[model samples]
Target: MKATRQLHDLGQSLWLDNITRSLLDDGTLARYIAEDSITGLTSNPSIFDAAIGGGDAYDAGIHAKTLAGLSGEALFTELALEDLRRAADLFRPVFDATGQVDGWVSMEVSPLLAADSAGSIAAARHIHHQGRRDNLFVKIPGTPEGVPAIEEAIFLGIPINVTLLFSCAQYQAVAEAYLRGIERRLAAGLDPRVGSVASLFISRWDVAANPQLPDALRNQLGIAVGQQTYRAYRELLASKRWHKLAAAGARPQRLLWASTGVKDPSAPDTLYVSALAAPDTIDTIPEKTLHAFADHGQLHGVLADDGGDADAVLAQIAAAGVDLDALALKLQRDGAAAFVKSWQQLLQRIADKASALEKESQLP
Candidate 1:
């Protein structure tokens, strides 16, 4: 079997961390679904920025929206939603087959709202409603401000993908927000089956810490962090609180591993994919990494329910003078900033494309 199929069979979801109009137009996304066992995908400002600025594939859409008086973020939203809604339809079968646990695609809210709880909540609602797909998740960052927005969005029954989490604590915060949302639903006699996922970023830890660590510890911190968080995830699933919610018909918010693409050139291309395999978790793989893993990735057995030597490795790193707690916060903040940067670039790309297209139209 292909390695992608192997991972899927082992119960880990492999979601393509990419989306482009070309992928949908040329059937690549569909092929991944049909052959590579890619049940879902997730997109962000960076991904959309690349898709919009990379080629002429989105030019026509940009031109139309521009002519229709849509520009900047507004234009970007219509363009993104067009792709997401189509991708959501393509994954509808897997979604239905798994009872909504699998075959999900995510769309993030404007990173500009990262610090505004009210704006985040409002954007999530508007985006999800505009998306019109039950399998679509509107991504909200897990910042201090975003936490309340996440809880409110969940209580409002909008499926959420809580993004930018870096450590077990961050994951737990979002998890608690999700639980609170479900609990609120139950108290109000609402259905508790709201779908959500707490996305923990991997790889960035090593990218940030590697320069300071000894060679032996290089590239190990991310997986260790993942292991630690996985332990927390398992414990939560087995917790009395979660059990109460489950019995009351609330679906557990799944843990998704983001930033799985290896950043170190010396590291094995499939390092993250091979190291973090586990049941009931989602790994959002970059297109390049997804192909590499499918070609030659190996399963090194599933992650231990107890987190294996995660703590020991973390201790060694701490001893080496890397403050894990401080670093997690830094990474989350950095990640959010990076998204905002990409979001700005994306809007500019749209404005530029629309202008050029309009110029060409006038000549004709």
Candidate 2:
């Protein structure tokens, strides 16, 4: 059996952290689902930016939308939704087969609104309503500003994928926000089972710390951070507050490992995927990493529920002069900014393409 199937059978969900018109049209995504045990997918501005900007696959749609007088962010979102809605439908079977626990596709709100909670909330609602798929999740960053937006969106029954988190504390905070949202739903006599996932970034931790840590500590920070966060996840699920919410028909807001692609060429390609497997959690992996895992990844063991060795690893990093808390905040901010930059570039690319296509169409 493929290692991907092993990991899935062991209880962790494998989500393809990418989507594009080509991948969907070419049967790559479907094959991953059918053979590699991939149960879900995730998309961000960066992914869509690369997808649309990297190829001509979306040119026809871009031309149509442009001819229809849509451009900029509005135009970009319509194109993105076209891809996501199709991906969502492809995964609907897993969603139904698993009774809503698996097969989710995530679409993030604009990164430009990262600091604007109200704007983020409104965009999330609009996207959720526009997609009109229960398997779709509106991804919100887990930054301080975004936490409130996450809560509000979840309270409104929008399935949320809390993105850009970097620390155990960050994960806990987002999980708490999700629980509060469910509690509110129960209070308002709404169903409490609105789905959510807190996406804690993994490989970026090591990427950020690689220059600062010694050779011995290289490529270890990401796994350590995931370990620590996994401990918090297990604790939260076992807590009384979560139990109350779970009994009230709510599903646990799962932990999702984001940014799982190995950045260091010297590191094992499957380092993050093999080491971070845990029950009831989701790992959204980039395409390269996903293919690498399917090729050579091994599912040796599950992560210790108590976060074995994570504290020691983190302490060593601190002793080596890394302040994790400060770095976590910086990563979250930088991640939001990076997405915004990618989003702007994507919009510009779409505008350029739309203009060129419009000129061609008028040449008739």
Candidate 3:
């Protein structure tokens, strides 16, 4: 059996951290679902920028939207919804079979609104409504500003993927926000089964800290952080608050391991995938990492419910001059900034393509 299937059987969801028109048009995404057990997908500005700008696959759509008086973020969202809706339909079976626990496709709100909670909430609602799919999640960052927006959006019944988180504390904060949203819904006599996921980034931790650490400590920070967060996730699920919510038909806002792709070429390609295998959690991996793992990955075991040696390892990392708290904040800020840059670049790419297409049309 392929390692992907084994991972799925072990109860860890494998979601492709990518989406492009070509993947859908060529049946690649469908094949991943049918064969590789990829039950879900997640996308961001970077992924969309690459997908839209990397090739001609999105040109016709961009041109059409441009002619339809849509440009910039408005144009981009339409194109993205086009792709996600198709991907969502492809995974509809898994969604139905698993009862909405699996087969989710995520679309992030404008990264420009990372600090504007109100704007973020509005964009999330618009995207969720526009997506028109039950399995779709509108991604919101887990930054301080974004936490309240997450709570508000969840209360409004929009499923969310809380992104840009880098620490256990960040994950806990967003999880609490999700709970608050659910509690508010229950109070309002609304359905409490609002699906959500707190996405804790993994590899970026090592990417930021590896340069400051010795060889023995290299590529280990991310896994240790993941272990620590996983422990907290298990504890939260077992808590009285979560139990009450669960008893009230509220789904646990799952812990998701994001940025699982190995950043260092020296590290094992499957390092994050194999080490962070835990049931009831989701790992969204890049296409390269997904194929690499399916080809040669091995799962030693799942993460320790108690976090194993994560605390000790993190202490050692701190002693090595890495401040975990500050770094976590830095990573989240840097990630949000990076997405904004990508979002701007994506709009520019669409504008450039549309201009060229307009000129072509004018050429008798």
Estimated TM-score for each candidate: 0.99, 0.99, 0.99
Candidate 1 positional error at 87, Å: 0.4
Off by over 4 Å in 3: none
Alpha-carbon lDDT of model 2: 0.91
Tell me, by lDDT, which candidate is best. Answer: 1
lDDT of 2 by residue, 246-321 (tens): 8877898989999999999998999999999888999998888988999999886899989999999999999999
lDDT, ranked from best to worst: 1, 3, 2
Decide which is better by lDDT, 1 or 3. Answer: 1
lDDT of 1 by residue, 267-350 (tens): 999999999999999999999998899899988899999999999999999999999999999999999999999998888888
RMSD for all candidates, in order, please: 0.7, 0.9, 0.7
Whole-structure CA lDDT of model 1? 0.95
Q: After superposition, how far is residue 4 of candidate 3 from its true place, in Å?
A: 0.6
Cα deviation of 252, candidate 3, in Å:
0.5
